[model samples]
Target: MPVLLLALIVFLSDQISKLLVRQWLQPNQSVPVLNNIFHLTYINNPGAAFGIFAYQTPLFIILTLAVIGIIIIAYKQFPIHNRLNLKLALALQLGGALGNLLDRIRFGYVVDFLDFRVWPVFNLADVAIVLGVGLIIWELWRKEEKGEAQ
Candidate 1:
């Protein structure tokens, strides 16, 4: 389906960007794209986003695998009608999860860059996952509103 294709695109792009970042930048190297406001700083995150739970590599890896499995089943179970947003959200989450999972398996950590001074440095996978979650939340809110109106 198109959502699956979208997932492929997100996954490939995330992996490719990580590959380039790892090759071009040394660990903890910062190249300012916007003079500290933004930069490409390479960091190998051994934990979840924002560096939380910084020592649970095995648990994170297992949880990621479970999320991937759940998404696959949810995607297939959903009927193809007017649920494009839901589908896309699931696809994105799947892709992002897989991207990070790949890094965790290969390097025992995830490659993160795209530094914004206000927040912790993150990468494309993080972005995709956040956007997907936002979309999912919006869909749920919409459904709740519809039910309320009914």
Candidate 2:
């Protein structure tokens, strides 16, 4: 499947889940999806991951756009086979970034709903970013092992 299509799926799923959570729960309110393990908690993060840059919306917006631009450029430049994983990772990141960017643009904050006590409140976007980054790192590691580059 095309990376863009996968990204769209991720973005749609994330937004739908967020919308449903918002419709059903109030801010700071949570329902136990799994007792003590998971809860649907609502939060508006006016910042980056883990609430960083809590007051830097403009910067965040600019950064997100720059990232999108870079991804588009990379997609055009990179060879298909070598970049399959990279494109997939970028698509996941793009979907996630767009998801929260939509919230930030519309509501002046990113809506986060998934809550795990071991970790701070986060949403699907965060998951995408983390997983995308992890896969990217793994790819790099595998490349080094193969002496493909570096």
Candidate 3:
């Protein structure tokens, strides 16, 4: 129940943020919240992260569907014990992937806005995906260390 709720929240937040950005900013127009540090710059990305493999909409859609399917299978296989963080991490990834998938289906691209001076411009969905992956890696490392110490 909690996992579903969290996933729903992430999905809704990502979609809403992207919609608002689309309405407020023109493509390639940027509004800086923190001068020279962060900005909201709208873009339609037709490829993977950092704009690599640009203009491959169909490939991205297929890949996103595959990833979502794998996440669902993995989530179902997780032991029903004290792994709330693991569940939440999967939820985040699932939600984020779905959000981007919808964009690809509807627009042939993903809507990205949040921008930092250094990294590639990305959206809320991308943020959730990265954070989810990071959490999973950290949890696995922690588990391995505990097992080693015992």
Candidate 4:
């Protein structure tokens, strides 16, 4: 899928979910989805994922914008016409970036709600970003391995 389309979907879905959480739950409230395993917890994160770099909204905002710009430029210029996987990975990264960026711009924080008791709370954007980056890394590693074998 086109990176922009994926980005729009992630951004809208993240924003809508955050809105729903804000409407139906108070900050710090927890609703168990899978007792002891998962919970829908509403929390405002003023920093990067999992509360790291807490309260650095401005820095995160600028960094996200720069990342988005780089993604767009790189995608258009790269010769990956047959590499659907890479394109999808890039799209996912863009989507996740835009999702969190929107949150930072609108509320000065990213709304996080997914809670796995032992882990820091996070949202879909975090999931997408992690998966996208992992995929990209894996792809690059595979390419290097193939080149070395050749």
Candidate 5:
């Protein structure tokens, strides 16, 4: 249930924000929300993060599918007795990946809007992916400190 909720929230948030950005901002239009720090800049990414693999749609599609499969298999390995964080992290990744994957399939690109000057421009799906990774790392560190890693 928690996993499902996490996935749903991420999917809904990502899609809604992308839709809003598409409606309000034209391609290459940027509106600063914070002085030199944060902005909303419309961009369509035809490839993976940092714009890698541009024009490699087929390769990205295949890789996304493979990642989805791996996430599922990895999630299944999570201990049933563990905290909900692991499930939530996996769910977040599942939702974010699917969100971008859907765009790649439908538009041949991923809609990205959120922009931070210090970091790469990203969207809600990117947030989910980063947060999910952070949670997983935190869990690993916690387990290691407790000598409970197995």
Candidate 6:
């Protein structure tokens, strides 16, 4: 129940932010929030990260679906005890995947707007996905270190 709630929050946030950006900015338009440091730059990404494999909508859709399925299966298989972080990570990944997948299905591309001027433009879903992966790695490393100490 908690996982579903968290995922729903992420999905809603991602979609709302994208919708706002779409309404406020035109494609390739950018509004700097910080001097040359950060901006809201709208972009329609038709491919994976960094816009690689552009126009490969079908492939990305399939891959996202596969990832969503794997996350669901993995989350269910995780033991109920002491697996809060793992479960949270999976929930985040699931939400982010669904958010982007919906965009891909609706428009042949995913909507991105947040820009740091150092990395490619991305959206809330991407942030959630990256944070989720980071949390998973941190949790696994902590467990490994604890095992070694014991």
Candidate 6 regions exceeding 4 Å error are 148-150
Candidate 6 is scored at a TM of: 0.96
Runs in model 5 deviating more than 4 A are none
For residue 95, model 6's alpha carbon misses the true position, in angstroms, by: 0.8
lDDT per residue (tens digit) for residues 8-91 in model 1: 899999999999999999999999999969999999999898899986889999999999998888877856357778888998
For each of the candidates, give the backbone clash count. 0, 0, 0, 0, 0, 0
What digit string (tens of lDDT, one per residue) describes model 5 on residues 83-129? 76778778889899889988898889999998998876788988898
Highest lDDT, which number? 6
**For model 2, what is the error of residue 108's alpha carbon versus the real structure, in angstroms, after optimal superposition?**
0.7
**What TM-score would you give candidate 5 relative to the actual structure?**
0.94
User: Which lDDT values do the candidates have, in the order given?
Assistant: 0.89, 0.84, 0.89, 0.85, 0.87, 0.92
TM-score of each: 0.93, 0.93, 0.95, 0.91, 0.94, 0.96
Which regions of candidate 1 are displaced past 4 Å? 148-150
Worst 10 residues of 1 by lDDT: 75-84
What TM-score quantifies how close candidate 4 is to the native fold? Answer: 0.91
lDDT of 6 by residue, 51-120 (tens): 9999999999999999999898887775635678887898899889999999999999999998999999
Residues 1-150, model 4: lDDT tens digits: 466687678767877888899999999999999999999999999977567898898999899999989888878888768777778778778888888888898889999999999999998888888887887888889889889432
RMSD of each: 1.8, 1.5, 1.8, 2.0, 1.2, 1.8
Model 3 lDDT-worst window of ten: 76-85
How accurate locally is residue 15 in candidate 5, as Cα lDDT from 0 to 100?
93
Instruction: Report how far residue 100 has shifted in candidate 2, in Å.
Output: 1.1
